[model samples]
Target chain A: MDLLPQLTQYAFSGLSTGAIYALIGLGFAIIYNSTGIINFAQGEFVMLGGVLTHFFLMVLKFPLVVSMAVAILVATAIGVAFERLTIRPLKRPTPLSMVIITIGGSIFIRGVAMLIWGKDTHSLPPFSGNEPLVIAGATVMPQHLWIFGLTLLVIAANKYFFYYTISGKAMRACSYNRTAASLVGIDVRRMVFLSFAISSAMGAMAGIIIAPLTMTAYDVGVMLGLKGFCAAIIGGMSSGFGTVLGGLLLGLLESLGAGLISSGYKDAIAFIILLLILFIRPQGLFSKAQTERV
Target chain B: MKRFVFSCSLFVLILTCSALCGASQPIKIGALFSVTGPPSFLGEPERNAAQMVADSINKSGGIKGRQVQLISYDTGGDATKAVQLANRLIKDDKVVAIIGPSTTGETMAVMPVVEKAGVPLISCAAGRKITEPVNRWVFKTAQNDNLAVAKIYEYLQKKKLNRVALLTVSDGFGSSGREQLKAQAATHGISVLYDETYGPKDTDMTAQLTKIRGTQAQALICWGTNPGPAVVARNAKQLGLKMPLFMSHGVSSKKFIELAGDAAEGVMLPSGKVIVADVLPDSDPQKKWLMAFVKEYQKLHKVEGDHFGGHAWDAMMLLKGALEKGDDLPATIAANLEKSRAFHGIGGSFTYTPVDHAGLAKDAFVLVEVKNRDWVLVK
Candidate 1:
């Protein structure tokens, strides 16, 4: 059999899933860069967005757009609140403690979600049409286009915010030197909280956008979180653009692996790439090599 | 000291009052289902079906004036959690009998607890080992993987598909199916052309399918839940392999259709009778009740009922019928179930004996094909 068409199909599938991973990974990058603490509950924020939206739209019979807006706003508020309560308390504490705290926070959120939502998988209406668009012998869902376009828009907006906005520069200064930024009268704490809000919103937005394709459930957050974390690490954890690239690469690799090789080992391909990257570069694709100052 | 004594007395009084109120209450049955994990697709439906059955029986004045109360716990598809849930249900909830810890892994995990507590436990999913070495307290409403294998073998023999390739998940369900298929294929003189296995959440099977393609196997038999069968369907189509594809009943879901798209069409599987409720003859013994159940379930849930839901309905109804027949709770229910014969159920006519806990025969399943992304009778 010809491999070109197969390869193309794999690429299309990869790109579709990659778009979602990039959005989630970008959320991870934002939190990591700002606070230097990985927000493990990022995926739960996404789940909360999709689930709340589903509840409002499907159960409460609210208008779809209204529900979507409410879900994003609510999820973002939750993110900010979580940081204020959990992460803020551990600001002066050890990094390991903060990491463990975030993990615990993730589990707590997931547990609460289970109790509230009753552990049912739910999906929202696709933002675009449901028809598959066949391009050059490869067929992809129209929703895939929506996800990819949304990912690009989010990335552009994020770039603009970080490079142009005053708060963004303050946030970047805090990331560079928290003590110095605090000395300069930059509200480092507020920046940290803002980072969480932005990251959580990104995650929630990813969930809302991709829920139509992958569906959403309480437990789905774990897998999404893990994949997004992998994407962040692979792309150079501090770089937003690198995170997106890494996510797309990882998604493409997994899909192509499934298409060309054994589908069963599709997930395995991600780790394998991870291992190879760590062995070869250690500093990640876009991360600068650090030298210890004497 | 007088105040402390008065507080203690009040606490005791409240406890006694609550205990007395609970003692005069309905017969409670605890159900542990994997309602929040990978298996939620199956467990959630089973829970709903169990609740539906309980509601129906209660609406009819329940079993001989005692209401059947179902207490459910989410196992999260973890074996350890299944045991924990089972203990909590038995101890805290004080349920007479437990209806499920759905999958075989979870059932086996909690089997010891049920056996030790001497409580009757009926599982909804199949793993033959659960009942085989004989745990008197442990029974199942669903047929074993071996029976499904036997049914598939019977069809393969009829279709003259002598050469077969196996693609299964490397888990309890897949391993059980693989072993059964291997032994049965040998007995039926069917050649084992190729065999491949994959992890549970795998989304591709091209490599295995390619190996099977080389073998020229007349049929490809896939065993796993959800995406396993979907991956097989998609990969098989991509490779242009025209062999007849057969799957284990685990993949009998709308999720498979949604995942596999048009590639799922023409895939054959040995499905439980409940899947084709409309195709059953009007004169069939359980037709009216089954149809009513389907209508009610669809009306309430807004989704088509699956074999999992049907099995739960049958199990709960059987238990209800047994409870209604006798005064004693556990003993009478067990005896009534043992003596039951040709009881018309959504899964077809069931006959339970002390030895056979499943209460259904191989004939309860009919071979079905995916036609236009929906299950259709093979005939």
Candidate 2:
């Protein structure tokens, strides 16, 4: 393995992980854009997707595709319920309070997950198989391809949802001005509900695709969630390609940094990049600086 | 005045009687385990094994006609909590000896407290530092990371695989194993080609493994607990790396095999003899004891006895041996444990001494490879 091959392998692996980060970051962006609250429990939805799929497939003996679909649906259901129970019921909602609530919800869901699934790490079989596909002396598992393909599919779906669909446009309206959107009969509350459902479903799908490679557990959400949040921040909380790019960049930097610099500082490199981005480009690299009128 | 003097004499007599009765009371042994946290796989089995041993001992007419009482606390794998719990066990519970704190970090944190309190602590964690420098009051049942390193090196020596890549977790267990791997490389006629680390919560190690693939190393040794090393094994397999992948004793459990699935095939690790007890010849001293413990643990806990539980079983039985021979005093138990010689129990035949508290040697571990998702003793 020469330097080029090694670097190529690193980039390939990084892109796979970056795709996951992008998916998770999109979840954070969706909720943030609509509700103005960071869904800290967004990561839990990812965990729930993987674990629930494992449960459905391994425990309940459901087929793989059925398990995946049900897992995503369950996670989306929970997301909608979360919006209804926590976000919508806030008599006096503040950004800090809502964020704290999401954090609390994340911990609660993790605890319940532990009790139900267990603390042991569980792995799902790869969707196709575990065969290696080589390209230019770099090898990747079939699951990596699944990650790339599904990430692109979800990003496309997300674009279509937010741009072409009426509900998505209404959701965008809610993001801009919930009061005005509601005044115009857009049903701001329903738009908020749709955003949670979409983001959580997307997040669950991300978790399912990656579970084969990374494995899943009740507490896996913490780090993945934090990393996804970082992705969202790097993308300046964009709901589309910006977040995807942010995720890819993060994954590539993490993988490359671990390979070239030192594996010991792999996570450190990620956090350092995050800090730099926050310092230099407060509004993120892609998103335009906004001027809001009161 | 005569009646008052008589009553005082009677009170003295009663106090002496109560003190004499206290001698027949059950011996209290304290245990600290991370029985419900991330390391619960280690701590849960240990706690269960200790309880099982205590119960069986009591069933067999007690330890020298006095019942044994095991007082266990869940440390939650936290070092600070372990120290606080250790203090409670020593000061409030007044146990004769302590069995665990499950993990190395917790055991190390609780070591100074036990030393100050003069309670003998037989830890279940495997970090060499737990028993290094020969702390008089601190001992461990898990084989030293140095011994595991030696076992791997010995195998490498036989296979003529000198150059190796080291990937260790940046935590207490991995760092300790990494240090030993580096320090003992020369002795075993091996050289390290690449040394890398990953966080405990890291999801992937393809980048690290890919770099190792680029190196001139003939073999790879990953030191970490479940999930992390499992991920490494999968990544290596994905890259089609033909080099033999070695793992430290940290992941010597069936859980690792299950987690890694097919990727676990061909992965080798140094493990306590407990996991391979049935395959051991009857001539082996620890076989009978190991078999009996496995059966008893399964019956009691409904789970197979792995290396971690075997550590607790060893700790509890070693303490029992000391208690049966000596009186119920911390000093007596410590002295008795120090005198332990060729005690054939699970985790190997432990021979404790005044100087060497870890007791087990390199032979405490046997190199085993995963074949068809089962541990096969490596020839």
Evaluated with TM-score, which candidate comes out highest? 2
Runs in model 1 deviating more than 4 A are A60-70, A91-93, A124-139, A256-261, A275-280, A291-294, B1-98, B112-120, B149-171, B178-248, B251-269, B292-306, B316-337, B367-376
- Tens digits of per-residue lDDT, candidate 1, B38-138, equal 68776888899999989988898777777889999999899999999899998898887888877888998898998888777878877778777766777
* Residue-level error in angstroms, candidate 1, position B183: 5.1
lDDT, candidate 1, A1-294, per-residue tens: 556665666677787777788888888888877777878888888788888898889888999899999999999999988988988876466668888888898999999988888655565676766555777756576777888888889878887888799988888787777889999999988998999999888888888887766667676787788788878878877545777888989988887675556655767888888788778866567767542100
List TM-score per model, in order. Answer: 0.80, 0.94
Two-chain DockQ for each candidate model: 0.15, 0.69
Instruction: Compute the lDDT of residue B248 as modeled in candidate 1.
Output: 91
Model 2 segments beyond 4 Å from truth? A289-294, B1-23
Q: Candidate 2: lDDT of A193?
A: 83
- In angstroms, how far off is B114's CA in candidate 2? 2.3
